[model samples]
Target: MKRRLALTAIALAVGAAASLSACSPGTASGTELVVTTFGGEWQKNFTDAVVKPFEKENNVTVKQVTLYSSDALAQLQAQKSSPQMDVVFFSGGQETVAAKDGLLAPIDPAALTNAPDLISQATAGLAGGRGPVVQITPMGLLYRTDKVSEPTSWNDPFNPDYRQHVAFTDLSNSYGTLGMLMINQARGGTIDNVTPGIDAIGQSTRAGDAIITKTSSDLQQAFAARDIWMAPYSQDYAETLRKAGQPVGFAIPKEGTTGSFITANLVAGRSNTELATKFIDYALSAGAQEKFVTGMAYSPVNTKAVVPADMQSKILAGPTLEKLVRFDPEQITGNAAAWQKQWQEQITR
Candidate 1:
């Protein structure tokens, strides 16, 4: 029943497709639905878990506009009047921004049959109070299985044994910022008091024991080249690297991990509002969530979504992980810019 499209998943990879311009919004006949998604494995997993199924069920062709989370919001804002994008997937902080800018429409909880399946916290800080949380990829510690003893604590990245070979993402990025939050909580500092985490990193920075990475790709490259033995980062990304034959391993350090939520939002005034909402609901459904976790190694926000025995150890499954740290998107989004400023002035120095 799934009708194949020429471009099932587009890997525009951050402006690779600037040569292509945005199109007009979909019509009332539901002939096509324009949706924006992030590329790479996440896009592929989403296509399999949700997009293809939605297409088959609705009998409409989907035109995917692949954009990074940050770029997706920027595009939406740029094209607000013309409304080329029907729905979008955004990282938590971006979602908060989109919500604040009035870019997202309110999702009627009644329409989302799978709404009740979400874990209590997944609904936090959403643009309209409720919708499908696309995926929860928690930030933790990833280490070189061959060169570093698996890190057992959040502080392991700073341990002198791996001195000068530890990678830390610059705090400008979400995962990097979330990593700091994990360290903050682990070191007995509240969100308001992150100086403990800052001071800890300063010790390593001043001692010349850390390698600062400007982007996620930089961190990955550092790991691949064996220049960094450990980092506080995404578990799924680490899994992706390991599956690609990198000698990497991931763990939720004893202090626990924090996560960034990817959310699907219904655009305010696209003609396909109903279909768009259905797509959002589908992403959070048990079937879709299960697929994302099993197929993509992303954490599930749905309580009913079951993890296969084989993937149990890879997710936030145990009691310890069940208590993993979660950030307030509103608080984080509101303060992230200021934090980035401080990070530039203090940590990155």
Candidate 2:
């Protein structure tokens, strides 16, 4: 009887241990992952769709911190000796800067289960010799249908008549910088060691043709108010406005629009290397990609994920998607500071 009782107690103990092990958090049982990203509606969507589901399934909680890209970069740079963030979601140029500064870990494509499903462009754009830095965003122009009779070309805002009515985010901002670069490219210029791009946009602004805002939300507000006819905008924002019954239309100009790629990178000094990789793998998974498209209205990087019919027809259709000019992060990051200096001096002045 004594032996049997002892055996039963041991069995119970073993079972409890196994149960606890199964419930351990993704980053080695008790450790929580610190994820940094842009806050607001997009963050909410990500939490609802990806973060919550991931936490439940993996038995791990994500502690998300909100910060602008520049501020986040500053924080990360400051903490290089004792990194606080486990993962970071930022623009291609920022990712390149982080990687160059040795603040990021190189991602192994072979280790990612869903890496196979990603499109060639996405993979190529993100993972170069230094490893993946960005997840690509196909960009184009957004216009108000009620005001404009025909689609405006990429260079249309450069015209004198439409100058004052054109609204764009500040060139210091990511989208604005991209828009400026695209215009420069269309005008047969380059952003590398050249101020023509900055000069042109600045001249337009000085001439009372262009309006600049700090955030995409502000740009959307202007569009909603019908204060501006058209500007370079994000597909996701344009979709959000359209869903709210706004008469906004997206177009890819004849010279081709610029595409922005954002990436989630591993922090430099985080101790949970295995867990960080797991989180990145899960985020880039096919399921997560599908959620990004369906819930957030952003295009999926995974080619295997099927985009909704309506979204595909409305946003990804025609020559627009085909003609999108993918921006080079290396070039952009190399010149970002100089561009900003020129922009302040020429355009804002």
Candidate 3:
């Protein structure tokens, strides 16, 4: 399709330009490190918990290039030969793309003092030993208290009563894509054959029941305007919204939830490998992981990171953690692009 082709062209153009600006890794000084990060509240939490502390301890000046994970990956691809970034943070499975492209170096676990504190899956989900998972937040439904009835079945997203008021993140978002997989499997379709899910989306979209928005801030505004009542939402966002006095509550669809694991990766051949590695190690330390989870409501990857008794039911851990719908990262990578294309062609039509 022209859209896909145009996107590819733009990327190629960006890559061509970035190669000129990207420098060789070993050429940099030890005092400066660059990282790609998201903006707004998430960035604030990270700055408080990870960035500020790392800078204080290591005496390094971290220059952040603000970017979403997807944008960061594209920048990496563009600048891989002479990457501007020293460390990258992205969702777990997504790092595999950078790994396959040879943009990420394998992390030395011995360099990480906090490595032993992580849960097995978090440590293992590292794009095949290329990095480490820093934190995780499970994805599920969140709804306004006054707008609609409780959602017991996952099928309710398509129900007529919810029509025109349901908000959804676009499929490009990890939560949105994984949400489709959960719905598909729950609707008796396999990951490889998600026709039922696609059909349901088409039906909802055509009926004008699906209101697609791009970010948490957008969702917050939509909820305030009462244009959206329910969404495939994250626990962290839900908690933040509730604390800010938005009448939001977690909705447990009978089908359960999926985890979105965040990973930290070192750029391949970066000049600041030592400092970059230390930053990652510091992030995984008990102190950092604790702040990351409790401050933002994301579940910590560190086994030793404490979740207070009051917060247990809201976070993924113990019994809730045990019940998560874990998918193969390889499965997602193999299928996601095709799925996104199909979703655009069919569901968004």
Number of the top-ranking candidate, with TM-score as the measure: 3
**Which pairs clash (backbone N, Cα, C closer than 3 Å) in model 2?**
126-132, 163-209, 164-209
TM-scores of the models, in the order given: 0.84, 0.83, 0.86
Please, what are the lDDT tens digits per residue for candidate 1 over residues 1-349?
A: 1333324334344345543322334333356778887777777888999889989998887788888877888887987766677788877567766777777787877788886777755665453543446687888898888988778888888777889888777776778888888887888988877777777776677678986787767877888774788888897888787787778888777766778777788777677888888888878888988998888888887888889998887777424334656677678767777777766666646
User: Rank by TM-score, descending?
Assistant: 3, 1, 2
Return the lDDT, model 3, position 327.
79
How far out, in Å, is residue 252 in model 3?
A: 3.8
Highest lDDT model number: 3
Clashes of 3: 2
Tell how far residue 98 is off in model 2, in angstroms.
Answer: 1.6
TM-score of 1: 0.84
Per-residue lDDT for 256 in model 3? 79
Clashes of 2: 3
lDDT string, candidate 2, 1-349, tens digits: 9999999999999999988764543322345778886888778877876688878888888889997777878888887776777888876457767877888877777766777766555556346323342244556688878877555576777766665668867766788888788777777787664566667777877888888777877887777774788888777777777877778887767776766666777776566667777777777776777677766666666666667776674555223343567667778777777777877898658
lDDT of 2: 0.71
Residue 99 of candidate 3: its Cα lDDT?
84
Q: State the lDDT of candidate 3 residue by residue for 301-327, as single tens digits.
A: 777778788777777763456567777
